[model samples]
Target: MPEEFGPVGRGEAIQALSREVLIRRSLDISPSGFITIISIIQGVALGLLAQNTFPKPTVLGGIQSVTLLLVFVSVFYYYLTMSVLLRWAPSFLDCFLPFVIASLEIPPAFFLGNAVAWNAWLAGFWFLTMGGLMITTKWSPVSHFGNVRKAHRLLHDLLRELRYTAGIGGFMVAFCALCAHLIPWQRQGWGIVGAGTVLAMVAMIVARTELRASQIHALYGVNRPPFN
Candidate 1:
């Protein structure tokens, strides 16, 4: 019988090692690294501002404040996520997911301002939770893109696992937001926020999947670049 081999089996181990060494030697500090560092600093500053600006110290209020923090985190996450994609997976269209996810928060912000009567604390809590989830979700591409053929299959598989796990985690966060809005105990305006959150998540998933699938197809010669 023919030998059944994995991705690593396709090439000699020594050759792969040599190539990795050469690639590392040739690589410079990625521009994205600088951007990521700056964004993180900015995010931390924003978080501090939110903490100082909002008063009221209750669990619900905390949730609201958290949600507000999430807004800035989401933007920072998007910046980092895009930077990673542009640096490593330049050919993939996955970089767009962060922007889409970030945009979804705008409507919720407006709704929260206009409709919800919650204290600043609760608003902050919601923002922090939601923003954290969105930003973390955007980081999924780090794993998925790392799965490129050059790395060992083990590395690729690990990245794939991380990507899926993050995706599910993000989905759960959004689902929780949705439920919070829908529950009778919560405010009515939150329902709009919840609905928008769910829809945006769905859209993000679809877009990412489509882009990934297209890349896979290209690899197999079933499709071409430029997507269709």
Candidate 2:
């Protein structure tokens, strides 16, 4: 290992890691907890909405049911990714992301309850919000490390990954917007929205996994691949 990347000493390394952990815990625990609460609310509300809205099978029932199911999965995926990010990386956006997710639950529920015809718009906005955040923000798990260069390198890598995520998000937003207008609110339209949501979810999953890998590299400092 290079001198710059070498750990200062076992005791100092432990102290640095421990302090970072403590600081993160203090800063992030509440945000993560709040996200979890919101996730529960979203899941329950969406479940009830699905139950009421899609009670019987019809000509387009299969498509609508599958689309709703995909939306539910997307919500669950968002909760998992956001909770992990809140727990691992501190950002000013933390204060806002949970509220955004909470607010989004309203649209679908309202649309279902009142029979509004804006599903495409709703889903398009979802992709745009999530992607925009992923592209715009910077988050890092390691702030204090015995090896300062390692910490900086990890932060750099994480930021680079965010750039890649942003590119994906940009694509998703454009595709979703185009689809939203083209089909608007047909059975096929919901399916299109579901496809865009899946892409957004995949991008989020990739970003989350990158974060986990960076956290692991920060802690373990293994020569092997971070994923392995």
Candidate 3:
């Protein structure tokens, strides 16, 4: 096959994208540690913010606010994972992330609700994101100028869409979660949970993403570097 030529981003995820357009990719999993730390900080901040913002919130509201925020931030990172590498069959696990990501405020919809539990889950989930980063870094070099392959093309398209859409969507969703602290939007916690579930279902049904990802992995061998 004839080779295509252009600059691709200098990372594992978006390396297949042309330099003609600006893009970014996950270079490594080292950022995992940073993500964990930041996630905890964000969770704490959210907790404090909720506590200070609304005096009438349930006793658990402060805690749930923080916990749910942690999950939301971590999920952003989860989707962020897809930007770099496609998981072959993590679909089943991915399906359950919504539950893992949050619990409840008034009734307390989750079990094992504790700071330790939240932090542990946050770290664990972030690890998955980091795993994706590591995998993508391994095969990043496979796609490059004058050496673009079919797998690279597919990856390029998928990754760009993943990053842009997920990045934007994550912020919006997080904002929605934050809104719960302010307005009485039908018990904001439930709204966040519902929105998360809807997004997850939509991703599964509309994207039908896992099969395509698995196929790309089988054909391209992204986990193995240089792809050739």
Candidate 4:
């Protein structure tokens, strides 16, 4: 059975073990902790607004306030997740690249959300920026203790992952742009854009899976014919 499975490469084995540890540690924390925390914060804010404890603002002002809040929350979440992932999976920086990319969207989303007042153009821009960020972060340098060599390896792996992720992002940008243009400017348009966004997200996930499989094949030398 072991032979049938082929020789286990040390790097592959380490990656597998590290991932298992990450999973186990993640499970130990309350699965709903993040959701619960967010919910509580939102509920408190809503209650304050309802009781007139907070001064009412114009619609644009409200949007800007919410966008700023989201930006801060997203940054905090990214820091927390990265800290945990780095501690758990020290070898592969690729695992955290997606999170970093996603986190970057918060800033731009905040800007566009405030500017467009939920306009499709802003929404589409948010998705496009998010996708682009994901692709960009994959190629960016990763540093720990300023070790140049280690950082380079991490960056290389990140770029490999990004190359796969960019395909998904490209599709999303196209779809979002289409929806932004096609949908009428109204609440219903926003709803349609939201649906399209979800579809794009699903596609991104599929792309990631396909890319990982390709990477594994390449790693195993399956793509290269043996010397005759």
Which of the numbered candidates is closest to the native, going by highest lDDT? Answer: 2
> Model 1: per-residue lDDT, tens digit, 1-228?
998966654446644447667555334344354454545555554545455445535444444445545545544544543343334322223334333444333333322332233222233333443554454445545344445552223323333543553355455445555555456566434534533443454445334544554455455466534224
Give lDDT tens digits, candidate 2, residues 127-156. Answer: 555554454344533443344556445545
CA lDDT of every candidate? 0.44, 0.51, 0.42, 0.42
- Candidate 4 weakest lDDT stretch, 10 residues: 82-91
Off by over 4 Å in 4: 1-78, 84-194, 199-228
TM-score of 1: 0.35
Per-prediction TM-score: 0.35, 0.51, 0.34, 0.29
Highest-TM-score candidate: 2
Query: After superposition, which runs of candidate 1 have C-alpha atoms over 4 Å from their true positions?
Result: 1-26, 29-34, 37-53, 63-151, 186-228
- TM-score-based ranking, best first? 2, 1, 3, 4
* Total clashes in model 3, counting residue pairs 3 or more apart in sequence or in different chains: 1
Descending-lDDT candidate ranking: 2, 1, 3, 4
Error of 2 at 213 (Å): 3.5
Model 3's C-alpha root-mean-square deviation from the true structure amounts to 15.6
Give per-candidate clash totals.
Answer: 27, 0, 1, 0
